[model samples]
Target: MKFYITFFAFILILSILIGCNVDQPTDVSTSSIPIDATSALSGGDTTILSESSHAFSTPAPNLSADALEKHLDGDLEFEAIFVTAPAEVNPGLGPIYNNITCINCHVRDGRGKPPTVDEKFVSMLFRLSLPNGENGETGQSPIPVPPIPVPGFGTQLNNRAIYGTPSEGTVIIEYSEQTLTTADGARIHLRYPDYTLTDTYKPIPENVEVSPRVAPVVFGLGLLEAIPEETILTYADEEDVNGDGISGKPNYVWDVVEKRYKLGRFGWKANQPNLLQQVASAYHDDMGLTTSLFPLENSHGQSQLKQNPTSPEVSDEILDVVTFYVQTLAVPARRDVNDPQVMHGEQLFAQAQCADCHIPTLRTGVLPGVPSVSNQTIHAYTDMLLHDMGPDLADNRPDFRASGSEWRTPPLWGIGLVRTVNGHTNFLHDGRARDLMEAILWHGGEAEKSRQMTLQMTTEERDALIAFLESL
Candidate 1:
C-alpha cells in the first residue's frame, strides 16, 4: 500500500508540472516564434508582394475585371500630359501652374523630393497665404478657419505659365548645416532650410505665410480613407487627458461636394477631406486645371484670371476614373518582418513610443465604391490626426484646423522603399531631412518625448529601430 501511494503521488506531481508549463510559457525568444500573418499584409487584401521600383503603381490584385478596367482607364488619364488650350489632345495645360501631369510630381506614384542642385522644381511646390487678422489667436479657436489667401497669388504660387502669362514667382532653397551628438557619442548632421521667393510678378506681403510641400506617396490611400472616422477620433486626445504627452487632433475642412465640413484625411496638414476632393484639388491647385468640384481657375481673382469656360477643363468622367485609380493602388507588403534584427527594432520602436502617433495596425471599414480596400486589416502606421510637431519643424502656416506647428502623421507603410522608387531619401513637409534618422532627430512638440527616448538609445538600439522602420 505504501509503494502504491508513492507512485500515485509522483504521477500527480508530474501532471501538475505539465499543466503549469502549458499555462505559463517559457521565456523563449520572440524570434523563435512564427511572425504574425498580418504583419506582411500592410494593406490587407490590397497588399502586393513587390520590392520593385513599380511597387507603388500596381493595382489591387483582388480587383474585379470591371474595376480593373476602370483603374486602367484612370492610369492613362493620370499620365496624360496637357498642353495650352486650342490643341486637340489634352488641352488646357495652364495659364499659371506647377506641372503638366500628375505623374510628373508623383513620380512612379512614390514620394517626391526637393529639387536637386541645378534641378527645376518638378515635384515640390510652395503654398502662399496671408496672416489671419481677426480669426482669433492660433490654436485657440474652437472652429477652424482657412488660411487667408494672398492677394495676387491666391493660395498657391504657380512658378510656370502659358505663353504671354506671368508666373507667380520662384522659390530658392538654401541649407545651413548643424551637428547633433547622440547619447552614444555618435554625431549626426542636420540641414536647416531657408526658403526665399524671387522673380515675383508682384510683391508678396512680408507677412505672407509660406509652406513648402513635397508630393507624398500616393499608394495605400484607399486603405487610409477606409479607416473609420470613429476609429480615428478614438485616438484623438486634444486635451491629452491620458497624460501621455501626445495630443492628436482632427482637422475639419470644407468638402466641396458635400458642401459641409468633414474630417480632413489627406495632405501634409490634413487639409483635404476625401480622395475625390484631394484629386480634384490637385488638378485645380497644382495643375491650374478645373473640374466640376473646383470650376474656377486658380488665378481667379488676379488680373491674369481668364473667363469661365462653358465646360470644366477636366471632365467629370476623367476625374472619377483618376480618383478610382488612386483608390485601388495596392500597398506593398512589408519585408524582413521575421528577421531577428527587424523584430528587435520593432520592439524598440514600440518601447520608444513611436507607435503612439504612427499607430502600427488599423482595421479598415468599407470605402464606398472601392470594395478591395474595404473591410480589411492594415498596418499603415498613421493615426490620421494632426499633432503639434514642435516649433523647429513648424511651417508657422495653419491649414483649416491644423495649427502652424501641427502636421498630420504621415503613413509609414512604404517609407522604406522611397529611396528605391524616388531615388532620394529627402523627407518631411519640406524635404529637409536627408534620411530617416535625420527625420527622427528633427521631431519636437508632441513627438518630443519619442525623440528624447530615441536620443537616449544606444547605437545598437538606434540601428535596430531604423532596421524595423526599414522592414515596414
Candidate 2:
C-alpha cells in the first residue's frame, strides 16, 4: 500500500511538471507558427476560420455545450429589436437612445459606419462635454472640457427619442476632401468630417467638445478580457522610459462590479473596465434600456417620462447571456498568411515600428466563468493601451485618464475583412479613413515614425506591407 501511494505521488508530480503543452509563439521572425497559424486558429482553438461575410458572427470552436447555448440565447437577445416605453416584452427601449438593438449599430457583430450626408448619424454618435463643468458657467480662459453628464442630455447625443420627449438633435456630417501622394506617387483622397447638431431640443453649451465614436467590432473579446493585467502592464510606458517614441499606457477606469479602479480594456478610449460593464452601459446609452448598472432614464432629469419596463429594464439572466455572446464571438482566421508577399510585408511591418504599439501576440490567462477563453495564444495585434494620437485624431474630449489626443490602439485582427463583412472599408474611430492605407496615413503623435516610415517605403514594399495587414 505504501509503495502504491508513493508511485501515484510520483506520477502526479511528473504530470504537474510536464503540465499541458502550450503552443503560444511570442516572436515575429519568419512568421511560421509552431502550434497553429494565426488565421487557422485566431482565438487559439476558439477560432472560426471563415472568410465569408458571416465570419465575424460565428461562435468560437472551443465553447462548451452550455456556453454555446448561452451564446445562442445572447445572439437572439442581441438581435431583438426594442420598442418604446410600456413595452410588455423586451421593454424600455428609450426616452432617448442611439439605436434599437445591439445588432443595429454593430451590424453583423462588425464595425459601424458614419451616416451619409443626407442620413442622420444613428449608430455612430458624438460624445459631448463642456470646458470645466459647473451648475452655472464659470469664467475661465481656455476652459477645460470636463465630461460631465450634460444638464438635459447625457454625454452621448441620442437623436432618437420615445413619444413625448424630444431628441437631443440630428447631427449633420460634412466631409472636406484632401489629397496625399504615396512614396510610389500614388495619389489618395482623404475626407475630413465636421459634425453639427441641428434642431437642438436641449441647448448644447457653446464651449462643448465633441468626440465621435463609431461602433467597433465585437470578436475575440472574451480572450482579450482574459489576458492578465500584469501582462498588459509590461507594455505600459507612461513616461516613455524606453525611448521607443511609443509610450503605450493602461487606462485605469472605475469598475462598477468591484467598485474600484481596474485596468481599462474595452471601448474606444478604454473607459469601461470589463465586458459586463460595457454591455450594460451600451444598454443604457445606446438603447435607453436601463440595466442594473444604470437604472435611471437617460432623459437627464427631464419630467413627463413614460413608464420604465422594470426597475432594471433588462433582467440579469438576459444581461449575462448577452455579455457572453459579445465576449465569446470568434475572431476570424487570417487569410493568405503564408503568401510570400504577405510574409515580406510582415517583415516590413516590424521594420516600420508598427509593432511597437500594436503588439503582435498575447496569451490569455484563466477566465473563471468561461474557461474557453483561457490560456490561449492569440494574435489580436493590440497592446490594449492608450497612446497620444496627435491633433489630427484628437476630439479634445477627455475620458478618465486618457487625454483628448490619446486613443486606445485598436486591434489589427480581422481588419482586412471589414469590407467583406460590413460592406465598407471605412476605418478609424469615426469611420473617416476610406481604406487601410488612409488609416495608416492618419496615424501621428506616438506613431508618426511608423507613418513616416510607410511614406518612405518603395511602392513594392508598401504593397507588401498592405498585404501583410490584409493577411492579419
Candidate 3:
C-alpha cells in the first residue's frame, strides 16, 4: 500500500512539471527576476528618458559645456529650412529634393513613416538601381551586385522637385491584410504594404529596381560607430559555420572620404562607413544639397536649364557640426523595467530567440571628441551585421556587399519612445508594421522560428513580451 502511494505521488509531481512547461490551464507566471537596477541606463552616459514629444531630440546628459554648444550650433543647421538660392541665410534649398530640412524627415530625431495612397513621399525615399550583374540561383548563397546608376534620375528618385523641372516620380502605397492565428486560438492581423510608383518625369529602365527606405532615429549613432569593427565582425557567421542557422555578414562599401572599401555600418543595408559620410550622402540625395565629398548636383547635373544651388550647398564647418549633432543625441532610458510583466517579458524575449540578432549588450571603443559615446556597456540590441530577413521582406535591391534579401539588423534601444517623440509606432525598414506585435509577426527567414515561437505563446505571454518591449 505504501509503494502504491509513492507511485501515485510521483505521477502527480511529473504532471505538474509538464503543466508548468506547457502551461495547461493557467497563464505563465509573472514573477520578477532581480536584474541590475542600472539596466535602465540603456545608453550609459547618453541615456535620457522622457515621455514628451522631445524625448528623442535631447543631447547627452553628461556632455561637457563646449560639446553641448557645438551640438546646439549643429541643431540650428539641421533644423534650418533651405530655400532656392539668392538669399543669404540658408539659401540652397533644391532644384530637386525630397524634403527641405533634415528634421522634416527625421521628425525630432525619430523614425519616419511611409506615405499613404493619398499622400506624397516626404519622410520616406526610394532607391533606384538595375541588376548590375549575374543573379544567384538561390538566395541562401551570397551573390555579388555592382550597382548601375539610372540615367537622368541617378540612384534615388526625387518625386518633389523645385517648381519648373518635373519631379522624378510619385509613389502610391497601399496595404493588404493577412490573418495569423496563434496556437492558443488568438488571432493576429498582419498588414503587407504594396508600393506603386507612377507619374515619372523621365523614362525608367525596364529592369530598374526600386527600394523604399524610411528615415530612422539619429540618436546614439556615434556610439554605434564607436564599436570596433573587429568586435562587430566577431558576430558575423556568413557561412553559418556553427550551424545555428543565423548567418550574419558585414557589408563592404565604398568610403568616399577614405576612397577605399571599408566595413559598412550605417543605412538600411549597412551601406555607409560613418556618421559623416551618412550625413554628406543624405544631404546630396535627400536635399539635393551637395558638400565637398559630393560636389555634383543630385540629378547628376542632367539639366542645365535648372538653377543650381551653391556648388556645394553645405560648407565643411556646417557639415561637421551637423554630424556632431546626430552623433551626440541621447538614447532614452528604459521604462517600467522592474514591473513583473516587463521582467517576465525579458525572459520571453530571450526564450523566443529574438536576442540572437538583436543582441542585448555590447561595449564601445574610444571615439575622439565624443567621450560620452566611448567605453561603455550599452543595450542597443543589434549585432550590426546584415542578415537575409526572408522573401517576405525582400526588396531584391542590392547595396555594396549586401544581398537583395539581406538587411542590417536595426537597433532597438529607443523603439518604445518612438510614438512619444514621432507620434507613431510604425516599425521596420519601410514602416510596414503598425505596432510591436505586427513587427514581431513580420519576422521570417533567420527569425522564422522566433516568429513561430512568438505565435504559439499564450495571450498573457504575448502581453508580457510586448510589455518588456514597451519598457525599453
lDDT of 3: 0.83
Work out how many backbone clashes candidate 3 has.
0
Q: Comparing 1 and 2 by TM-score, which wins? A: 1
Each candidate's number of clashing pairs is 0, 4, 0
lDDT of each: 0.88, 0.81, 0.83
TM-score of each predicted structure versus truth: 0.92, 0.88, 0.90
The C-alpha RMSD of each candidate to the native structure, in angstroms, is 14.1, 8.8, 16.2
As a TM-score, model 3 comes out at 0.90
Cα lDDT tens digits, model 2, 1-472, are 9999999999998886564211121222223343445444567767765789987998776676688788989999999999875667777778788898999889899999998767766568888766554322321112222367666666888888877778888777889999878777878788988877778785777777678999999989999999999999999998899898988877777787798878889999888899999999898888788878877767647542555445888888989999999888888778787789998998998999998888888999998798889999888889999898888898877776777788899999999899899999889999999889899999999999998898888889989999988877
lDDT of each residue in 47-100, candidate 3, tens digit only:
765667877888876677688789889999889898877678877666778999
Please report the candidate that would top lDDT against the real structure: 1
Q: What is the descending lDDT order?
A: 1, 3, 2
**For candidate 1, which ten residues in a row score worst on lDDT?**
24-33
In model 3, which regions exceed 4 Å deviation? 1-35, 134-146, 304-310
